[model samples]
Target: MRSDTAALTTITLPEIRLRVRDAHKLRGYFGELFREHSPLLHNHYEDGTFRQQYPLVQYKVLDGTPTLVGLGEGAALLVELFLRIRELDIDGRHYPVQAKHIEHRTEAIGPVAGLRRYRFETLWMPLNQDNHRQYQTQSAAEQQAQLTRILTNNMLALLKAVGAYASDMPLLLVHLLPGEPVVTQFKNQSMLGFMGEFVANIALPDGVGLGKSVARGFGAVRRVD
Candidate 1:
């Protein structure tokens, strides 16, 4: 007879996700949540380094329910914060999300080569000194070039910070998927940041986020397949 564990495969989740009821009502600054329950993390990681090293602990309202996600190091923080805080109140409603009760799926890592195309629901590529002059009149090709450079830098940084020594720079390709990109609407302005599809030449594990403001609900992406 085959051992029960013989075929078991380990799924290295690129991100850890948790669910909360009445997720749509969750509001207020993400910094507040960390400061209140995970103060040390707030002071050391969340303040700045986190945005560079890992995606911040973030929540999103999907299907009318709130979902909490941790990326890379943020995963550990998510688990700890939920356990310590037990329940939290954001905006005005209460969320009884506990680490024990938090839900997750047993997953197995898939081929890194298979994960190429990705869809971004929100992507905010910030202005940099290098490209500040091209902000207004940049052509589509130029914009793509800038994005590729920025993305390459961020990924390399993540690998270095995590001490993943074999990161010889995975192949990456950027392009826009044919369709209307999502636009962010504000009371006074309408901004269309980076939102589209990316086809990487290498395996980018599922749940890898890119660009800027990923912690605050921008630049969240998943493998298209």
Candidate 2:
């Protein structure tokens, strides 16, 4: 891989620190998604920059469940996969995974206690328009089955980029901005956006926030073993 691309491919755990008027509110917010995704030790601030080694997409969960609106470029593909999974028209046979999936893996630790530990991966699944249309026509059972297959394949690809044991499972969070968000790209940094002067950034050092060297080392070992 090119140095830059290799750099980009590296996965890092996110660091977040949350401050709130009521600690229970904070726990309630994360507890909503605890069964499916994990929250690691991250810095908290009413307003400040998230510390990262690379530029990645960051979401501020003003609410518990992350909707699709929370994703930036760093998280777009994963969120897109989630959207595809949810677009299923059938009932009962939704994607085998649900919002509660991460909650099952949640744990309470020290100061950073009461959150889950999670891993993340990304995949690029190129599909033709014909398959897309066919996907739309399938029965709920068939559609969910297809989604399971597709999700598994995509997650495998994500593992190739990151690792197999990064997170317990995959979850999608969305943005709930009242209106359109303004996005700005930079020459040496991550993407930034604004929704009515409230800023949201998609920078790197993502995936539960591990450093580049450590991520690469883990990936290398996984590849060889």
Candidate 3:
């Protein structure tokens, strides 16, 4: 009998769920992709670093009656290609998969606020493949471009699954840096020490001042650290 006691490594990706005026259309589009990418059973190592053994593809739906939509083998093939394209060596580099979730606010708030609210929860998981020192050596532009690429790729893939075009939405990303208190909360919950450097943001579509207003409300959190 095989022991089911494999070490568990959790990587939380908090995504900013963009609003689609047509939810039914969006669901029909991504339903296929979700079914394809999520593995019925995943196997990986728990060494707390990025090894070749870490599974690169994963999927789950939360807080809504959203269905699991995957493109099966087609998505698997894409994942394989994505891995090849990335070819990110873990031996001395660190990257994080930060998820951002955005939702519409039914109730209204302060003066001149839009009818939507964007809530961002950033979960940071360090890649042990590379030393932190080596990873920070890149120019700021290089770092932001790389981070944007990783994030946009995932977003595009998910959007493709749902049959929606991100080009239509025109995402305005506001990157954020965490403060000491927020870091403390994450450390307590995740048992992983916070680096105090994670790309978290509250994104808003056009015609919305909610994200901006929220950013002003939380003054301590810097745009970038």
The candidate that achieves the highest lDDT relative to the unseen native structure = 1
| TM-score for each model | 0.61, 0.23, 0.26
Clashes of 1: 3
Candidate 3 — number of clashing residue pairs? 31
In model 3, state the lDDT of residue 216: 12
Which structure is stronger by lDDT: 1 or 3?
1
Error of 3 at 89 (Å): 36
Q: lDDT tens string, model 2, 145-220?
A: 5544543443333333432223433332212111232233222333322222111111122322221212111111
lDDT of each residue in 7-72, candidate 3, tens digit only: 111122233232222222323333233334433212223443322322222222222211111132
Q: Which ten residues in a row have the lowest lDDT in candidate 1?
A: 1-10
lDDT at 222 for candidate 1? 68
Off by over 4 Å in 2: 1-130, 165-225
Ranking by TM-score: 1, 3, 2
On a 0 to 100 scale, what is the lDDT of residue 205 in model 3? 20
In candidate 2, position 49 carries an lDDT of 44
TM-score of 2: 0.23
For model 3 the local lDDT of residue 67 reads 15
Native-vs-model 1 lDDT?
Answer: 0.46
